[model samples]
Target: MNQNRVQASEVAPRAGLADISILANASLTSVTGTDMTSNAQGSYDLALKYSGTGLASVGVADKKVLVYALPAELQGKVVGGATVDIDANLLPITPGDIPGVSLLFGALGTAIDGVDKLVAIPAVKAAFDSLSTIQNLGAYQETLPATVSPDGKTISVDFTQGFGKYVHQAYVALFDTLRDTIAAIDVKNPIAAIPVKLLQEASADLFAIIDAIADGTSDILDNALNANLLGSMNGTLHTTVSDPGVASATVKAGAINNALISADVLTATEQEGEAVTLNFPTTAVNPIENYDVAAPVITQPVAGQTQVAGQVTLTQPIPDGTTFEAVVTLPDGSTKNVPLAADGTFVVDTGSLVDGQTISAKVVATNGTYTKDSPITTATVTAAPIENPIADYNVATPSVAPLTAGDPEITGQVTLNQPIPLGTTFEAVATLPDGSQLTGTVESDGTFKSAGVDQLAAGQTVTNG
Candidate 1:
C-alpha cells in the first residue's frame, strides 16, 4: 500500500472569492511511491478550508456550490459518501434539496422542536396540523449513491442549498420569533406564549404526529421527498463562518473515502502539486432515481411450534434459479441439512430425538442476485406413552361331590391361553347350595378345590362349595 498527502494550506482563493485551501490525504493500495495502477481500492480523508476576504459577502441565505475536478483516470468509479454537518454559527438554517426522505426527518425534527416551544400559538398549531398530512404518505426509501458524476471526475458540494436548506426556514423563523417573544413576556403573567389550555392539546398533537409516523404514514412523505434524500449525490453542510475580514472554518466531507475507493481514484497518477480546479454548477446534473430490491420471505414451518413427528414444508415459493437449503439443529448440539423434495417438504425423525429436547429449522435461499434466511422454527421432543400387556385366560365348570355326612368339597379348573408367569397365584370362592360360601386356593396347574359343602332340603341338591 502506498500513502500520499496533498496539502494546499496556502492555496489562494479566487480574486473575489474566499481564500480556500484543500488537503487530499489518501492511502491507495495500488499506488506505490510515485507510480499508480488501475482499479485499486483506497481510503480518502479530504479536508478543505475557506477564509479571508469576500467570504462575508456570501449571505447566510445565498447558495454556495463547490465542485472538485479530478483526473480522468478516476472517472466513473466513485461510490459511498454520507452525513450532514454544520456549525452553530449558522443560525436560521435553511432547507435544501437533499436526496431522500431524510430531509423530511430533518424538517420533522425542526417542526417538533418548534411545536414544543410555540404550540400554544394558533398559527403554530395550524402549521402542525398541516404537517400532520404526512401521516398518509409512504416512506420513500432507497439505496442512495455517492455524489460523483457519470464520468467520475468531479465531486460537487452545494453548501448553501444542501446543508443550510435542511434547517427549515418556516419552523426556525417562527420558533425563533416565538422564543424571543417568550423571553420578553412578564414572568407574572407567563400565559401569553404558554397557554394553559393548549398545553395538553399540544402534547396530544405531538404524540399524534409521532404515532402517525410510526404507523407507516411517513412512507408517503418519504416517497414525496425521496428525490432529495441524504444518500443522493447531494453535498453536505460544512459550516457557516462570519468574521471581520475572513472566517477560518474546517469542513470535512464524510464517506468521501468510499466515494474515492469505489471510483478507483487511486488508479489516476498525478504530481504532488498538480493544480485541481474547483468549479460551481447551477444545478445537479444527476438526480437519484428510486429503486428497490425485495428480500426473500419465509412462510413455512411456522415459527414457535411443537412437533413430535411430522413433516414440515416450506410453504413460501422460491424464485427460479435460486438455491434452497433447510438447516436443522438437533438436540445433541449437532446441525444437519435436511434434504427438501421438489414440493419443499421434509420430515424430521422425532423418534430419534431425546424427550424434552428442542430442534430448530430454518431455510436459506440464495440466488445470483441476493441471499436470504428465513425465520427460525423450533419443535420440542415429547416421549410417547407406554401401556402394559393384557393377559388371556378362561374358566371351567366346577365338579361337585356327594355331601356324605361331615365330608363336603368341590373341585374346578382355571387355565390361561398363554404361558403362566412364574410367581402368579389365584384364588376361588364357592357358593353352597344353601347360599353359604367357602374359599379355596388354585395351583399353578389350574386346579381349584374347596370344602364346606352343606346339604339342602328334598328339592335342593348338594352343590360344589
Candidate 2:
C-alpha cells in the first residue's frame, strides 16, 4: 500500500484563516462561524464551536476551509475519524512558524468527522507539514514569534531571535564540514564516523549557550530584531542585551573584585530597566606586604689581618626590627656607615688604618623596606717590626792547650755589638780555671769552638764567662 502523494506546492492558506465564513444552520447539530478574514482583509473571526450529536447531514460549505496537502508521509501519524464536536480558534503556531494548519486545524476541532472529513485532515496536514519542515531548515529561514498567554494557557515560542541565528548557522556549517573532513583524513590511516548522541547534544547545547552568555543570562538572543537566537531550553530565554562597555578604563577595581568574586547578586530584575541589587563584599582582606632579606654573613675581621679592633661579627641573627649597618670599603676608595649592635655585632674605628692598607667590609640589614648586603670582608694592615739593641758582646779569649799530652783544647771567637736578625742564638760562658760553665751556639758570623774541653789545666786559664 505505497501511497504518499501530496505536493501541489504543498497547499497553503492557514495564516489568518483566509477569508473564513462557515455557517450551517437548520439544526444540524451545530457548526457556526462568521466572516473571518485576513490576507489583509483583516476581520479575524475564528470560533468554530460545535457540541456532539449527529451534526445533521453536514451541508453548508461556503467561504473555504479546504486545506489538504499533508503527506510528508502523514507526519505524526494517527488518522481515523468520526467523532465530531468541533472547536477551532486557531492562531498559536511557533516551531519556527509560518506555513501553518492553524495548529493542526486547531487541534482537529475535536473528533471531527462529518463523514471522513478528510480523514483527520491528513493528520492536521501532517502537523503543519512538520512546521513547514522546521521553518525551512539550513540557516533556518525565520518566522518564530508565537506568544499567546494571558490565561489562554501558554504558547510562547520566541526562538530568541531565531535561535541565535540558528545556532550560528549550525556552528558555521558544522565546523566548516569538520574542517574539511579532518583535512581529508589519512593522518596515518585515520578513520572517523561520529554522532555520539549528536555530539553530546551539540556539546550540551553549546555549553548552555556559553553559560547564558557569560552571566548576563537570558539565554542569549539579544534581539537586533532577533537572530542572535540560541536558547535550547536551559532556563529558557533571557539576554535582553546590555553588556558592552568595558573597553578600558584600565579596568582594575582589583580586576572588578576578581571578576565579581563569585558572582550572583545583580538583581534589579536582572537590570535592563530597574532591578539593581549589587551588594559585593564577600569578606577576606589582607594581601599585599611582601618581603625578603637573607645575605649577611661576614663574622669579624679575619682573613690575614694585622690590626682591626672592636666588634664585627655577623653570621646573621638580627631579625626583630632589624637594623645593622657597617659598610667600610676603604683602601683609599673611602666609605663608612658602621652602626650595628643588636647581636649581629659591628664597630668600625679603623683608626685611620695604615701600614699596608686594604679594608673592605659590608653588612647592611635594615628592615622596613627590607634591605640586604654582606659579602665583602677583606683586611690587611700589618704593623709589627722594629728591633735594634745589643750594646756589647765581644768574647774571644779561650786558649787552653794540652792536646797530645793530656787531651784538652778550647778555642773561640765571638763578637756581636749590634746586627742581629739572622737566626740569632748566643750562649757562651766558659770560666775554666777549674771553674767550668760552657755552652756554644753563636756562629753564623760570630764564632765559638770547643774540642772536648775536659782536661783544661795546662796553664789552667781560659776565662770568658
Candidate 3:
C-alpha cells in the first residue's frame, strides 16, 4: 500500500508515561494528574477527578471527556478532534454534566469553558428531577458576584480561582434569559410605552450594581425589574418531576433589557423608542383569516397610565389558514419569531375584554414568551341567549277571536292561527224549515260541510245563513 494512503496503524508496543494533567470541572476522583503515551497512534492514559461543579445542585453527572488541543507538543500534527476509548469499567456511561467528561485537561482554565456539551438531556432531566420543588417555584434573581478592582483602574481578573463564579454567572445568564424570554411570550407587542420611572429605576439599579462590582462587593438589584416575570408566562409552575421538557415545562417570559427600554428621540419624525406597527405584505403565504389571533384594541390614554395600542394585522393576506406568522423586529438586537395565530385586532371571546383585562394569546414561534396586553376595548359581553320556559310562555303568538255560533256557512274552509291538536271537535248544527236541527258529520280531517237547503224562513232573512 502507498505510504500516502492513510490506514489505521496497528498497535506497536507499550511505553512510559507522557505529559498529561487531568483536572475535573466537577468533583474529581482518585487522580488529579496522570501520564499516558502514544500507544502506536498517540493514545494516552489519563487519571482525572470530578474536581469542580457546573452548578451546586446542578453538576455534570455523566462521565465527560474534555478534549483539548494536544498539549502544544502535538498541536500542528494533531487531528481535527480526539476520540478516547475507555476501559469499560472506568466510564460505564456518560454523566449528567453539561460536558460529559471523565478526564479534563485544558492548556489553561479556559479549556473547561470550551467543553461544549455540558450534560445530556437524560442526565439533565435526572439531575434536575432531584430539585423539582425549588425549580418549579423559584424566581430567577440576577447574580451578585464579588469584584476585585476599583474604578478608573485596570486589573487582572482571574476568573479561574472560584468555581462558584462560573456557576453564578451561568445562573444569572440562564435566569435573565429565561425571565425576559417568557415575559414576552403571550402576545406580539408588550412594553411599548414603558414607564419612565421604571427605566430610571433600572438605570439606577445598574449603577449601584456597577459600583458594588468596582468596589469589590456584592452587586445590587433594582425593584424596577419586573417582579412578576417568573409567573407571567406560566414559568416556575409545574406539576411533574421532570425538566428539559422544554415544550411542556420550559417557558420564556421577557426580554426586557436596558437596550430595549430606551427613550431619547433622535430622528425628526421618529421618536427614539417609539412603538411601530408591523404591517405584513398582502400577498402572504398565509392570510389572517386562517389564524385565530384577536387582540384587544387600545383606547385613548387612561388617567394614570399611558395607553398602548397594540394591533397585529397581516401584511400578507392570510386566507382561511390556521398558522399565523410575523418577522417582528424588537427594539433590542433580537427578532420576534412569532408564529402565533393571526387573530385580527381583537382578543378571543374575551368576555368583552373591557374590564382592564389584558388580551394575551399563545405565541407560536420559537422564544415567544411575553403577553402583549394593549388598551382594552369598551365593548361589553352580555350573557348568551338561554333556554328558559318562562320566556317561551310569555312570548306568545298574536291573539285571535273565537268563532261565533250564529255564523252561517255551507262549505267554507276555516283555519286557526293557533295550532289545533288532533282530537279537537266541532260541528255543523244547521236548521231546516221543518224546525229540526240539520246534522252533518265532521270529516276525519276535522272539517264539516252541508249542501241541501233550498227554501227556508223567507220572512226571517237571517236564518243562520
Candidate 4:
C-alpha cells in the first residue's frame, strides 16, 4: 500500500486533550527493538511545554507516552483513584479499515518483495547454555527463515533495503532457525526483548503500523501511544522536608503518580530548583481525584467583603418554582440552618467565622419547615475571621465593596503582628473542605481588607464565609 504521514498538528483539534506531537515521534529507550542486527531503535522521545503553574507544571514522565502534572488548585486533596483521559489521538485504525487484521501494512517494502537480513538476538539465560551455534547464525544457507509475521504472509526487511537475489533463498533457510529459537523462549515474556527477538526481525512491520494511514490505524496507534502519555498517572508518591529553616532552603522530591505506566521513566531526583535525574521503575502510580464532571467552578466573591460568603444561587435545570434548603456542616460537625429560595440559593454568614476551619455542605429540597427526603447536592466552604476595625462593621445594606443584594460578601477581620513589609501583601482567607487559605487584597495595607480572593469552589463545605 502507499500513503502519506498523517499530519498530527492539523488533526490536533479532533484529538482534544491528548498530545499529538509525542504520538508521532516518541519511542521508549528501555525497550530493545525486535532485531539486534537490523535497523531497530529503542523508544522515542516526546517533549511537552510547561503550560501550567506551580503544582500543574510538575513534569512527571510516567511513560514514553504517559505524562502527568497536577493542577495547582487540585493539590493536597488529590487522591489515588483520580481518573484522567488517555487521549485517543494515538490509537491505530480498526480491523475493518485494513484489508485483514487490525495491523496496517503500508507502502514500504513488503514480505513478497523486500530483501531480508538476520542478526543474533539476546536470548534468556535459561536457554542460552543449550542454544546451538547453528541456531545462532542469521544466515538462511544452513537453516530456514521464519515468515515475517505469524500469518505466514509478511516478509521482513531493513529500512536500507540491501541484499540481492541470494537474500530470497537465505530468508527461507534462516526463518526456521529463528522461529525455533524464539519458540524455545519462555512464553511469559513473549513481548520482552529476550523472548521476542522475533520483533527485532519484525521491526519494519511494527514501524508501518505507526507510520501508515487507514481509518482505524492511526486511531489504534493513537490509543496505544496515549496509554503511556504523561498525564495518565493516577496515584501519588510524596516526600517532605523537615524544619527547613526560614532562611535555609529545604527542598524535597515532589510526589510521583504512575498508574497506567507500562514502562520505566526519568524524573528530577532533587528538589524544585536543582538539576537531577530520577530513574523510575514500572510501579510508580500517582494519586489523583477522578471528578465525575467538570470540577464545579468557584464563583468570584462579592466586592467589599474580605471573605466570599458561603452561598450559591443556581437556576433549576427542570424549570421554575423548584426550591432547595441548605444545611451547612462545619468541619466540627455542627450544621447551619438556612432556607434555599425558589430561585435556588442559600448563603452562610461568613463574617462570623473563625480561623483555620474546614467545612462541607449538603442541600435538601424544602418548603420552610417540611424537608424532603431526596438526595442532597453538596458543596464545600471555608471562611476565617479578619481583624479589620469593628468600626467597619456598621452593616448598612450589608454593603461589601462590589456588593450585590442577592449574594452579599462577608468581610473577615484580622490584625497583622507587624506592619506588612513594603510590597508585601495582606490577603483575606476562607475555610473550605480543601483547607483554610489566604484570600484577597489589602490595597498596600498590612491589614488585609478585600473581598475578591475569597471565592468559593463548588462542592466545598461552607463555613462562616
The digit string of per-residue lDDT tens for model 4 on 122-201 reads 44221222222222212211111211222211111111011112222222233343335445544343334432444334
Ranking, TM-score, top scorer first: 1, 2, 4, 3
lDDT of 2 at 165: 39
Please identify model 4 stretches exceeding 4 Å from their true place.
1-322, 341-343, 350-356, 367-465
What TM-score would you give candidate 1 relative to the actual structure?
0.25
Poorest stretch of ten by lDDT in candidate 4: 37-46
Q: Over 4 Å off in model 2, which ranges?
A: 1-323, 327-336, 339-349, 352-365, 369-408, 411-420, 423-435, 438-447, 450-465
Residue 68 displacement in candidate 1 (angstroms) = 50
RMSD of each: 21.6, 31.5, 30.8, 31.9
TM-score per candidate: 0.25, 0.20, 0.16, 0.16
Q: Residue 329 deviation, candidate 4, in Å?
A: 1.5
Error of model 1, residue 386, in angstroms: 2.8
Candidate 2 vs candidate 4: the TM-score winner is 2
Runs with alpha carbons beyond 4 Å of true place in candidate 3: 1-340, 343-371, 378-411, 414-465
Q: What's the residue-level lDDT of 267 in candidate 3?
A: 18
Predicted candidate 3 versus true structure: per-residue lDDT over 170-195, tens digit per residue: 32332342223223323223432233
Please give the CA lDDT of all the candidate structures. Answer: 0.38, 0.33, 0.26, 0.29
* Higher-scoring candidate on lDDT, 1 or 4: 1
